[model samples]
Structures are given as structure tokens and as C-alpha cells.
Target: MENPPGTIGPGWLIKVSSRTARPDPGACPTHLRTAVRPLVAAEPPVPFRRAPREDFAPGPLFAALDLWEQGGWSIGRVLDELRSTRGAFRGRNAPAHPSLMAWTVQAFERYVAARHEEQAAARAAGLPPTVPVRLGWTARTKKKDAPDARGGQQYEHTAWGRQYASADGSVRDLWIPSLGRAKADRAAAEKAAIAHVMANGAPTPHRRRGDTPPEDATASTRLPERVRVFDFGCADGSVTPLLDWHRTEVQNRFMADAAPAFVSAATGAGTRPGASCVDCKAISGCAALHRTPRLWGAASAAPMRGRRSVSAWDLRLHGECPAQYHLVRQLHLNDLSAENDGARRGRAVDAWLNQRHADRPVRGCRDLPIPDASSLPAAHPLEGPLAHVAVRMLTEHRVLCPLNGIGSNEQVLVQHRVTAYVPELDVVVLAVPDLLYTRRGDWIWRETKTASRPVWEGRSLLRSYPQLALAVLLFSAGALDADPRRSWVELEHLREGRGESRLERIDPSQPAVVAEAREVIADLAQPLLDDASYEPTTGRHCHGCQARTWCKPGTAYVAEHPQGVGRHPDAAEADHFADRGSIHA
Candidate 1:
């Protein structure tokens, strides 16, 4: 069936409400009805670059709220229905709240009078039939006992119920309560209710159906020259008056001089006191705010923060800086471009190794199958050097590593992904060992890195090797044995054999092992765990960070100290900077 012209569709009934808090250093609400923002951004998520929308669902409270605002029903009939029927998904309905019920009654009476005046105008103008006011709604009731202890009963709507205006649809006896929760519902409630309540002592006409006249058929329904708004707090009963649409225009013009400005709390970029600061997700580690809000108490800190899985890379990136971690690892806003030669070389080398090992294990690099370099890519410029480096690393490992030879009965895994939940830490640990195998009955988990500096060159390998520590934690946890190979974690530096291809056997029995690993995880997660404050640490590492272009500190530092053709990182380091958290979350 076609909808009548001017008849409001259910979809267009309620505007999408968001947490639009008032910008401070602006005009305060003279009457609260003028407020447009909500208390929170709990707007239903929508696709990026799309307008926010909320599906209209009309049950009891929804129907009651809408119908009263639109002048489709009187509160008396609604209350009777409310007594008999139960509402679905009931929350904040305020069934026994006198303020809610009174407001509903007063608003409904005002809406009916204003609507009737419009009908009268159409009749006087001899225009075509103007659509009469109708309510769009749905209703439901309790079918059975609710699963939970509280019996969930609802006043289910049964049919398309409606009420019409009297012949003389003029101003009505409307009163805006000086006090109560009488503020406007930003989306659904119309201004007609405010129009009536603001009018002083307008004669409220009793409602009637289209065909029948009211008990008192002689009510006036003339349109008023102006409408007003009011505010009512639950605590105080005084109704504070607000300006009508006409008055609001002036405030809009005044405020237009300076638009409200908002800055990311994480950046500590704003000076104006914002009402939303309390709920701002980026408030943690805010230098301007100088506060760090934590989620759980010290008692639940470890378990709560570690509940969600994080990778070895996640721990490492966070260890560097929480702000960088938030950008590269957490939000993934700074996906590094693969245009660098080093990145291409790393990919080519990785692809070659995986293909070579996945086919059949070759103990010697000379026996390893080499792929045609032309088939790789035009973008991969370091193909020759990358190939040579791979061969050197493979040969060195074959000669020095105990796992160079293995029998068919021996267990071995290549390029295998390992994930294990650390019970003590209460966080999932993920690591992909390039070579995991048994050598003379010794189990080892090894990682290969083609970096400028090898693992063995570092002064304190343990201090320099947080990722290795995580690898050991995952390896030992995945072993299923109380302790495997006394928890061995190795780092294979594939930088032309400048450093020793060494392995560090960690003792899981040592309290420090678990303590240190947990500390690393906590350090990486604490900022995010606390309040998602990813503040920039402002350090030297910011130089080549691809994401630094978008970071606050990086941008600030660059703005302050502009330099010559600065550092251009070689291609090989590109893959190292990419914060690909482990395979699993």
C-alpha cells in the first residue's frame, strides 16, 4: 500500500542521536530543549564514509515515546495499555516515574492542537486532502517466563492504534513543568510538544477520531504565532524555558563566530575544557591532562590486560613506544609501503626459503634449489644480493647448527607458526620459528633475522632480545612437556656470518623468566590496557618510523628541526620495521 503524502515514514521518525556534548566556552542552554548532542558516542557503528542510521523499532516504550510526541494517542489510553501489556527489551522506561507520564500527557495534548490547526488551514485554503496525523509503531508482550531471574514482561502492541484532533484544533491548555527530566529526546520527539507547552494557558482540546467529533465539539485548533521550549531536571521540578525555533536562530548566528574545536586527547592538543574529557578514550598518557587511567586494579592488572592475545612483535613495538604501538600495531594506520628495495629483497628471500624447504629439506645450501631471478619481480631490486645472503646464511647454519642433519623418525618443522596461552601471564603468546626441529634429541626454536646487526653483537643479548624471550615462552608452552630442551630459544643472524649463529637456552624454572616475560607484555599493553592512551614517547627511533609522519611527536619534531636530504633507510630494514603482529591476535 502506498503511504499518504506528508505522512511520516517510520524510518524518518527518529534522527540518529550521537554523543554530541556541548563545546565548552560556548553559550549555555537557556532552555535545555536546544541541546543537539548526546551523552556518549554510542552511535551504532556504520560503514566508513556513511551516515549514521538506527533501525526504527516500535514496541511499548518506543511506541509510547513516539506516539505521545506526535499527538497520536492520549496518556490515559496509553497508561491503560501499559498496565495490561508488557514492553520488549525494556530499559529506562520509567513506568512509575510521574515526570515521564506527566510530560507525555502534556506533550500529546499540545501536538493534537497544533496538528488540528494545520488541518484547519488546509480546509480554509481549499487545498487537496492533507494527510491526517497517524502513528507508526509495533508492540509485543510476554510469551513465557524469562530465562533470567527477573521475569521479563512486556506490553506488546497488537494493532495500528491512533487518535485524531477536534474540529477547532487551536492552541491548548499546555504546561511545561518548571522541573523534572523534561528535556527533549534529540531524535524522535518533535517541536510541536514544545510549541504547545511554551504557549501560555492555551485551551487543550480533547482528541477524537476522523469520523467522530469530540465530546466537546466546540474546541479551537488555530495555529499559534510562536512556540517555546522548556527543560526539567529530575531533581528539581522547575521548568526552565527555552527559545523557540525563531529564538534559536539568533543563538546559532552568535555561536557561528567560532566553531567548536576538538583535538585528540592522546595528542594533548586541546586547551578548552571539554565536557567529554571524562569519557574520552584517548585521555590516558595525555601530557596536557597529565593523567594515566588504568582499567583494572593492580590485583587484576596482569590477567585483565593479557586476556586478549598479543604477538612477539606487539610486545617489541610497544616496548619501543606506546604511541607507535597504537599506530602501527594496534590501529594499523601506518601500513608501510613495499616500494623499498630492502623490503622486496626480504620478501623474495622469504618466498625462496619457504619454497625450498616446503618441497624437500636440503641439508646443504649448494644442494638447495635456486629459482630464476627474472621470475621474482621488477620491484625487487636486491634479488642478487638477497639470493647470495640467503645462501650464505643457509650454509653457515648447516655447518654450525646441530639440527643440520635429521632422520625420518626425528620431528622437524619449517616456517611453522606456534601459538600458546601463557597461563601465568594470562596472555596468548605467538611465534613462528623459521626452523623448529630436534637435533641429537635436543629441541630448539630458531628465528632468522637479516638485519644490519646480528643478535650476538649486542652487549646484553637478553636486554636486546625481548622478542626472543617471547619465542622461548611460546616454544616451552607449546612443548606440552613440563620443560623441553630446558626451554631453548635461538637467534640465527643471516648477515653474511659476521656474528656467531647462537642459541640461548632459557630456564623456565627460574622465576625471572616468567617475571620478565610478563613484565614485557604488561609494558606493551599497559597504555592500551589503561585507557588506550597511545602518547608519543618522543625519542630517536622516530627518525625512520614510517608512521612517524602521522605521529604527533614526529610531526612536531620535524616541524621544529627541518634538515637536509635526511636519512633514507636501505631496503633491507623495511621488513624489520613492519609491525606484523604474530600470526594470531
Candidate 2:
């Protein structure tokens, strides 16, 4: 017997239970019948009475909407029903605006229009029309006619609820998203979607130990294939696979274990508060997090707004930690910082570089002007000692920098932003360079990275960084005349006032270089299209993560990992991709 995972109610259920017992072979050997034994003592017969039915109390339309989601209704199916009876929808949660009602209705309109045209074409061709089935949240099953009768009558009712099966009734593309709801919670979407996925009839490959064959079968149980679920923010009725629930082999094994540590799983506090617990409404009720004051900081923090386009910073953070990415980007948690003071200071220097370069407006050997503390705007935080440090770094770069005979006469594009449309990825690729200048009529790009450790010790490591690799393609495909042999992109490290003496050259003309460059960029950019692909990879960098207090895995890793928190080697380089300032905020 076991209690369901997130229940506050008193509900217990047998772990391995069946509605019917082992069958008797005498009645029907092929399809076994329920076993029956002769009664020793017969009791007085009682009048037949069916189970009492509760009155259907409609609270609001949103409640039914939620129930349909939990019931695994397809997007088209749910929207079609909703569109027909929107005016008569019960409940206070019905949309206040008519436009809000059109969200799913629009999607349904397209589907219906396409179907009508398909029917017309089929009729003209003298063929049968293929009408798509809009399945309701019910399954047809045979019910026992009498107490002793076995599977005599069939009726339509909910068993586990219908998953969003395809037109041909395939379970492969089962996905449910909370559409067109503005205050829609991520947790609620996950709960509704995952429940539907589990029940949607994906066949599991694994079998139970105490299983029986058809000869002695009662309940014809089969392993349900694993169902993949995607949770997207602001889904807009589109099931974009932006993120998915990826369980490690260990996690899978643990969940599949016959005996699991229920107590530990239930009351177990997170090793450390992470993005998952930041705005958790149940923290006060949770005994594990109630005593932890450090985690409380996240709850006080605000959230971030949604994004119109994706950036390198977006990809990197989402790759590093999906939870943190959601908190920073989806929630717009601006008050929280993802990087430490030193890395943030480096970004401040980048801003200073842009300002300094803009003043010269030339491609020759130039000097970076130091900013005066008094000259900073009221919003700019770099003042006093911080301002002095910024000036000192600029001065140090002027003297120690090794740039003299690199570019001939091409104009310099400081803080240059280059964009390319990648149709395969369904989004534009953003390739921003610190300084972009041309050589031999080909644009040469140089990116300044502020890191405690050298980003790339050797030239071989240049191919590994997609920001540079992607720039090669973005520049070549454009009118920039980015010749592979003449033009090159360099990664300059801005630690202790040192710049790249020799830049890494890109041979864009070479078939190998072109193929490799696009492949690398595509691999990174492609996953962003799907919501499920954004999974968090916990590592030593978790210690310095600003969202660490909100990340459970991050905290657990900090406590259990060998790196032991603080500043990791990859921290600075990874954070160097902050949307570089454009002189203004």
C-alpha cells in the first residue's frame, strides 16, 4: 500500500492490486473466467442498489478547463469543445475578455478550415473524406453486468482519462500545454501534463516480477511505455518542446524500485534552496525549509519577464541550470544576480570598452579613455573605488595591449551585433563581437573575454567555443565579405592586461570549416526550439551561482561535490556572454 506523491488528503492504495482475481480454466480456457468457489453457507439476499452518484457542481469554466487538461484532452479537442459552448461555460474563472477566448479558438479555426478543404478535395476525387477524431476525456470499457457476470456490458466513462492521441490513435506525440492563460503557474502545467502523459497509453518495456500469463490472468495488465512530457511558459496553444523531464538512469532505477524510501522522499529538505524553492508557496508548511533563513531571500526576490528572442546568454544559462534560467528569464527576477561581483565588474569593464571605442571612431591603434567617477550617470553604480578600478584597467590595457599592424584600412565596428536567420532552428542566431574590423576586404572579429583563468590555452580550443564558430558562419553568409583565409576571429583574455598576439583564423572557403561551423551552431540553437530540452546540468559551478539559494540540486552538489563551491574555472568565461552593454542600459 502507498500514498500518492503530492497529496495532503488521507488516501492510501494497494501497490500491486487488481479489480479481478485469478480466473478459472473450466469456463473459458482461452479467455479465462473469474474463479468461483461453492458457498458453504448462503445468507439472505439483499436488494440490488447501485453506488450513489454525486451531483456535478460546476464552479467555473477554468475548473473544467483544468479538469480537461488533467484528463489529457488534446489541444484541438479541448479548444473545439470550448469554442462551441464558451458563452455557457460555468464558473467565475471564465476569461474576462473575448480576445482571451479566441486564443485556442484561433488554432481550432485553422484546423477546421484545413479539414473542410481536405473533405472538398476528397469528394471531388470520389474518395472517402478523412475526418479527424476529437476524442473526449473518456474511454470505452466493458463493465460487469452482475456481481457474478464477467465483462458483459460496455460503457463510456473515465478510467485514467484519454491522452492527446494522434489522428490515427498513436501515443507517441502525447503533449498537453496550458494555453492562453496569463497567471498560469508552471507547477500546475507540469502536474496536469505529466498526469496525462503517464495515462495516455505509452507502453512501458519493463515487466513486473509476479506477472501471470493469459491462462491464469485476471486483470490483463501491461507495462506502459515511458511517456515524455514538455512544460512551456506562455505556450500560446502551441506545444513547443522547450523543456522536458529528463531522468537520469539512477533516478529511473530509484523510481522503479519496488520499495522506495517514502518517508525520506516526503519530508526530505533540499540540500540547498534553489530556483525551484525560490517562490515556493508551501515553504512555511514544509518542515525541511521552514528553519532555513538563507532560502527565504529568494521568496523576497522578484521574477523576470518573458523573452521575444533567444540569445547566447539565454542558451548558456538554460544549459547550466533550467531552474535558474526560468527564474531569471521567464520570471524576470532582475533583483537576483547570476554572477559574482568580480564577473559583474568585468561586464562593467566591457561597457567601459564600448564607450571608449565609440569616442575614437577609427580603426587605427587607439587609446581607451578612462571614465571619471563624477561623470557617471545617477543609475551607474561604478563610483569611487569601482570607478577607479575601471580606469586603471583601461590604462593597463592601453599599455600592455598588443594590437598595432592587425587591420589595414577597414572601419571598426565596436560592440557589433550580427544576426543571421537559421530556418532549421526557427530562430535568428545572435553573434555579438566586442570589436569587428575587416582585413583584405574581409571582416575580422575580436571578442574580449574577462576571466580569472585563460579561456583557451591553445588555438585547438577555439573550435570548441560556438560563439566564435557561429560568428564565422553569420559573417560569411552576410554581405560582410568574411573570407576564411584573410579574415579571422580572435578570443582575447582581459586578465592582467593581456590581449591575443595571434588571432585564430577561420577558413570559411574550406568545406570542412563551413560544415563544422554551421553544425556546431545548429546543435546549440536547435534545442532551444523545444521546451523539454532545457535540462539543468549540476556541476562545481553551482557554488558561485547566484540562483544557488533557490536550486536544490545546486545546493546538494555544493555540499556533496568535490569542487566545494566559490569560483569555478568555467564560471567567468561562461558568464562573459552577458548581453554586452551598448553604452546605455
Best by lDDT: 2
Every model's TM-score: 0.43, 0.42
- Candidate 2 overall lDDT versus native: 0.40
Model 2 spans > 4 angstroms off: 1-308, 334-338, 360-396, 399-409, 479-485, 497-505, 531-533, 559-569, 580-585
What tens-digit string does per-residue lDDT give for candidate 1 at 1-585?
111121212111111111122233321121111112111121221112210111111223345545444546676766565444422223422122222233333434443454466446546966333332242212112334332222122211111223222234321222232222445532112232232222312232333322222234223334333333334332223233343343334234323421121111101223221222222222222223212112111233333331343455665556666665554554333323334444555555555554545555445334544335543434334546665665555455444443445565556677654434322333333456666666555676665555444454544444455566555444444432425445566665555563544545555446566566556545555544453344566555465454665455666776675651232343234354243334221
Q: Relative to the true structure, how large is the alpha-carbon lDDT of every model?
A: 0.39, 0.40
Give the range of the ten consecutive residues with the poorest summed lDDT in model 2.
33-42
Model 2, total clashes: 32
State the RMSD for candidate 2.
25.2
lDDT of 2 by residue, 77-178 (tens): 667666565343434422212222333344344333433553475469654433222333321233333422222222221212113333333222223323
Worst 10 residues of 1 by lDDT: 10-19
Model 1 TM-score?
0.43
